[model samples]
Target: MTAALFLTSCSRKIIPGKPVLSSTRFTTDSLPLSEIDVPLRINLKPLYETANKNVQTIYGSPGWPNDFEVVNCDTRYMYRFKRGPLMITAHANTVNFNFTGSYIIAGAQRICTGTGSNRIPITPWTPTCTCGLNEGERRVNIGFKALLTLKDNYDVSAKLQRLEPRPLDKCTVCFWRQDITSTVMDQLKVQLDDTGNEISDSLNRLNLRSPFQQLWDMLNTSIPMFGMGYLQINPEKLRLSTLYAQNDTLNISVGISARPRISLTKTVGYRTVVPDISDFNQRKGFSIFVDAVMDYDSLSQLLTRELYHKRVDMDKTGKYIIIERCEIYGAGNEKLIIKIEFSGPDKGTMYLTGRPYFNRGKNQVEIKDIDYDIHTRDLLIKTAKWLFNRRIINTLNHYSTFNIAAYADTLLSKVNVQLNRQWQKSVSTAGAVNNLQVMAIYPLTENLVLRCNIRGELTVRIDAFDF
Candidate 1:
């Protein structure tokens, strides 16, 4: 419009003696600025290759990091029903990157007061988007209608390919069927331990406390499925909106607290696998499996039975299952090769460098790491002294009596207690102690819910490409 105005004004004030030569030249007079055409060089193959790689990274795989709490495990019986529980094993019926644990899987339910397959797109002309020229994005519409039932023998083996966790933009959820009985309904209520501590600490470290609290309040406001419990999670930059089970979609809304970008860099070496706890330039907080298991033994027993039944059934399908302490070694073979057990939506991994490598006195190398027995022995001896701290402390006190032999006999003989006594001490040399202030306060289980979400992944290669 401005260009048109300038051209119109020029035409109205045409000089009596001047004459327009060419229309192109005349149009140039009203142009905004001089234009430059720089020669361009682009390798389409590499450009498209990079784009494809990035797209695969986004859609091919998504998930949280895996952690196997090192402990021996054995399966036990929960309530040996005359047979096993009758349910649809995920092995038989599952989706790509799907996990098993009583999934109330939800699909696109064209939300509307009026609806039909003939739906409309609602992409609003959002005011301002800080999108860059090269910003890439995609949205996939996936849904299907079906009726699944649980038969008496739900034994089936299956493959579960894991996908990355995306809580913000995309809303993939497990919704309980409206027709489920109250008894079967309890299973849907059981939440996965997505490691709230990990999630919360990650949020806290990311300075997202306000938004995190807002989400908590929303979920706690009311139990979803109590009628039609809905868990709407929106994890996005700049803002977040979540609705657990509140009012109608109109009144129920969550405002996303503005957020920042996350970047990370790490260094690793032997002594400490992670030499620097340097915050990855990006927001750093991990999903800590904080579902406190107070009675370790009892909890272990419970999980054992659950896992045993699940896996026994999983094996029948012939897919290698990766569970805690499964002791998978001697790689190469796919059927028996599994690395991680459970992962959350956005699990993180801190890959430390260096390893438990043996250094044979300067140059003579070619040495294997310490044996597990040796490691356990060292730890047990230290643990023995720790379990009996009173005796150890009393002996150290008796050293003030100038009995070097007694101190050595009390501590050195059994434990490798590294000690360094300063010839003279400066009281203020060290920092203050804050034992009381450093409260390791655990939250009441009531405030926190235990969610047991699972992740599955199928590792495939980039076999072919298309333009």
Candidate 2:
């Protein structure tokens, strides 16, 4: 059967004190995202490949220029010839940049354009036939750097800040027998500036909207299972912060504000957000409070299996006590009422009450302040002392103390095993539970509730599309 689950934090050390019984009620309060450091890496290989493909498709047409042009100053004439196709190359370095630094370079080659004319006339009276031509194209190297900034509009934009000119590669060309070398160099410089501007504009349009939207949808659904149960984080909204380039990879810290729920069944649908996105606090580290329910029927079955039909002897006069069955229920005021039926000369039911505490060192939830119910104690002392004996009281106390602890440990161990196993995988996220302690335990109408606080780290690897 499926059970309801809630979330809370863990205490660093176990508190040494006696359990106090009170009539106070408890409820879960809204929690903020833990102020913890989560590092996310983004690969640039795919981005480079996309850019190269787009450049080739857009510029590799039959009508596009494939050469450079040179012009004559005296005749105002231009000469053009075939050279090679314009090309763009991209290189990414993820290991050289700091967390806040930005320096990415892209190179363009064979970029030039000009009008052409012929100075020779066919006849003395005829004017020279003029036609445009481009030639002597070579690689003009340039450097470009941009800063990736996250805007409040939930988009990422690359701002080009610097462009540095580098020496051009050697080129083989036929000259027009004129002093036009300086003019040609100046024209090439202009081409480099124009080309660099176009590239920067294209890069600025790159945003992480699509990929992150997919990730948000995935997280809103069921996550990896923990034992038979799965964790579901129903996020109210997403918040982005601290985006910078580090070691060649883009590091983005995402803060998710969610009212997450956990369930054992798979039939539950998606949870909707009730609070506004502005209500979320943007911080680091992680803390969760969980309200775990223990059903009375399940507790009864477990106790009966462990203690039923087992006899405890008080004296050698055949005065032995045999447990028939056990039942547990809530007493409404932070108390668990346990009823035990015995088969002996006394042959009656007895009641006990207690408070619960989480033992961090032992990793157990022990029922403390255990004592006989006021009415039961008087009856056992006055009428059933011979058959029930005082030893039965001690035996009942011991059973209640350790049984709950064993149950809590078993549940926690299963969760820890699943989390640890995920951590060992190459492309999976894992969580470590530290300082887990019980905050409070109260009896509900249907089930006993144990509120707990757990503090820990959640590490997610971004490689191989792991979220």
Best prediction by lDDT: 2
For model 1 the TM-score comes to 0.12
Task: Report lDDT per candidate.
Answer: 0.20, 0.49
Candidate 1: which stretches are off by over 4 Å?
A: 1-249, 255-295, 299-372, 375-467
Q: Tell me the tens digit of each residue's lDDT in model 1 across 335-425.
A: 1111112212111111101111112232111112211222222332343212112331232122211112332233222211111111112
Per-model TM-score, in order, reads 0.12, 0.63
How well is each residue in 1-467 modelled by candidate 2, as lDDT tens digits? 11112222321111112222355564334443333333445555445544444332122112224322222312222333221232323223211110111111111222223434533323222122222223323333444555556555544466553344433433322322333334444544454444445545655566665445544564567654555355555666566554655443565556665555444444354534332223223355556565555667876776787788978888656777689898877644667777777765446566777766566666555667777776565555555555435566666666754344554455556665655443322234566656546666656646765565656665454443311
Off by over 4 Å in 2: 1-36, 56-137, 165-167, 170-202, 209-239, 257-285, 313-321, 341-351, 359-363, 369-390, 403-427, 464-467
**Residue 81, candidate 2: alpha-carbon lDDT:** 23
- Could you tell me how far off, in angstroms, the CA of residue 171 lies in candidate 2 after the best superposition? 5.3
**Top candidate, metric TM-score:** 2
